[model samples]
Target: MQVNATPNRRLVVGISGASGVAYGIRLLQVLRQIEVESHLVMSKSAQVTLAHESSYSVADVKALASVSYANTDIGAAISSGSFPALGMVVAPCSIRTLSEVATGVTSSLLSRAADVTLKERRRLVLMVRETPLHLGHIRSMASATEAGAIIYPPVPAFYANPQTIEEMIDHSIGRVLDLFGLETSLVRRWGT
Candidate 1:
């Protein structure tokens, strides 16, 4: 699984309270397989969502990442622009988290790190997962974009013709990793 990323290149992963907890989990798994280091932070609400959505425990999820930071640890290493990560991704980002990032009002380390990524001109991808979006959600997404963050909703690529949920998950993740210049064959390209 060795790939484009250097072993030292780090990616910050934030998991918020969204229905699609599996997205974050699978992202970590894929990162590990490709030998990319991962730093993980989870909102407290994400723990609750994980219990409702997946069979894995918090410990199980935490184990996937190279470093796990407490959401309350606002002073963690990744919270600073000097940390030199490739980027940050909030897989299945909750609306609450999106609002904070949009307003630059960070209540947790996860959001704080996201802010740092944007301020440092590094990649900041938010997988906003809420549906039936209203005007506020649309406006917040615009704000995040204006701040140099990429709003990547994890819409399924039916063109891939995924036969299983895991394949669908991998396809979505592979595309997201592509944003960081890491390549993976998990995705079925349109023409290869």
Candidate 2:
């Protein structure tokens, strides 16, 4: 397939302990399919969640992206404002990560990179994966949104009539990619 001539876009994907590990993995897959370079980072809890949700190992998850950084690697390129990434996404973003980013608490590389993205005025999408959100969660989401981060919960779309997990994952990731100005045909349109 002929790839687009546009400059290769850089995307930073952070995975947290949230339940939707499949979203992060599938997002990487779609980015690779489009020939975009991905920078992947995962929290320690995310590793455990991935193990419980899928057969892939941490190394396997790392292989999905062009570059992988340790969650504690604060010196990683993506953690710096100098790094010119097109955007960042924290799929399956846990409440802890959300709070950290919202408050500018750089406990890990994930939150630091998110802070960099916001400070640099780049797209930051958080695919929060919790159910029955409380007031604290709502406040965190509002805080991040005020700082220019897009909070996208993994709500299923009935319009697509998803029949499988992969389809649902694709739909969510596709919408997230749209936030980065990437077009995808993974999900059907509303007026179609």
Candidate 3:
């Protein structure tokens, strides 16, 4: 597949069935605010988690992205390496999603796109949201890291002195985007 010679201010966003769906939501919001084109894909389980975690419906969330894809759509634009993008971010990445990306055996568009990002040698950030890790979880993270995927656990920076949950979420998401060098005012740098 031929990659477009032109560069794009584009990114692929994946939302799995993690607890913090707000991270993915805010990521789309910020990407939009910054004029970046976002191609979003959400796992089926993510719809359920979105309903439980936020007031927004699936359609409402999809509205935030420039292009939205169904999880089962393996033929989606993002599923191909030729799709020009900064890379993919699986915000609030569920354990299952992380394991899939690690093993390169993707069952859904979200993980398949992530695997493509790694294979294409582009940045793939996983905002893995979990705690009480077992050896299996650690191994998956290691595997993902070895495969060139950034294993970014959304550990908050209290030094930002965020007063609200929204503020904390914004700060973490901002840092994640920073991995791609897309800076946003959402984060308050220390002593700045």
Candidate 4:
């Protein structure tokens, strides 16, 4: 896949240790199909999650992205506001990652890149993948939202009449991409 991105077509992708690793994987594949340069940063725990949740290996998922970054590489190009990405998305964002972004205590490159995106006044969509909301999780969501991050839980759109899990995943990611003005046919519109 092409790694070079046009001035307006680059996006940063961060995958945390969330259960829905397939969300991040499918997002990368769709980005490639749409000719958008994807800068991927997968947390170490995300790799472990991928092993448990999906059939793809770490290398397989990394290959889907245009550019891949080590979660510990704080100096990665995407870590800076000058990287010129349209925005960033953290698919299957874990509570830990969300809290870090909310508190601005970005210990790893994933959250740091998210912080950079926020500081740059760019869109940062967090596909939070947890249930049983506690007051703490809600507060973190509020804090992240106040900091200009969008807390997008990967909820299934039953109205879309999805027939498979892949369809549901595509719908959620497609909506997330819409926030960055990227369009995809993966979404089944409610009305014709």
List TM-scores for all candidates, in order. Answer: 0.95, 0.95, 0.96, 0.98
Which should have the higher lDDT, number 2 or number 4?
Answer: 4
- Alpha-carbon error at 37 in model 1, in Å? 0.6
lDDT of each: 0.91, 0.89, 0.92, 0.93
* Candidate No. with top TM-score: 4
Which segments of model 3 are wrong by more than 4 Å? Answer: 1-8
- When 3 and 4 are scored with lDDT, the better candidate is 4
Error of 1 at 23 (Å): 0.6
Off by over 4 Å in 4: none
The candidate, 2 or 3, that scores higher on lDDT is 3
* Count of backbone clashes, every candidate in sequence: 0, 0, 0, 0
Deviation of model 1 at 60, angstroms:
0.3
Instruction: Write candidate 2's Cα lDDT for 1-192 as tens digits.
Output: 222223237788999999989999999889888778888999999999999999998999898888899998989988888888788999989999999999998799999999999999988999998879899999999999999999999888988999987888888889889888888888677888
lDDT of 4 by residue, 104-153 (tens): 99999999999999999999999999999899999999999999999999
Distance from true location, Cα of 5 in model 1, Å: 9.8
Q: Stretches of candidate 2 above 4 Å error?
A: 1-8
Poorest stretch of ten by lDDT in candidate 1: 1-10
Q: Write the per-residue lDDT of candidate 3 for residues 1-192, one digit (tens) a residue.
A: 122323457889999999999999999999888888888999999999999989999999999988899999999989999888889899989999999999999899999999999999999999999998999999999999999999989898999998999999999999998888898998898899
Candidate 2 TM-score to native: 0.95
Q: Could you give candidate 1's per-residue lDDT for residues 113-138 as a string of tens digits?
A: 99999999999999999999999999
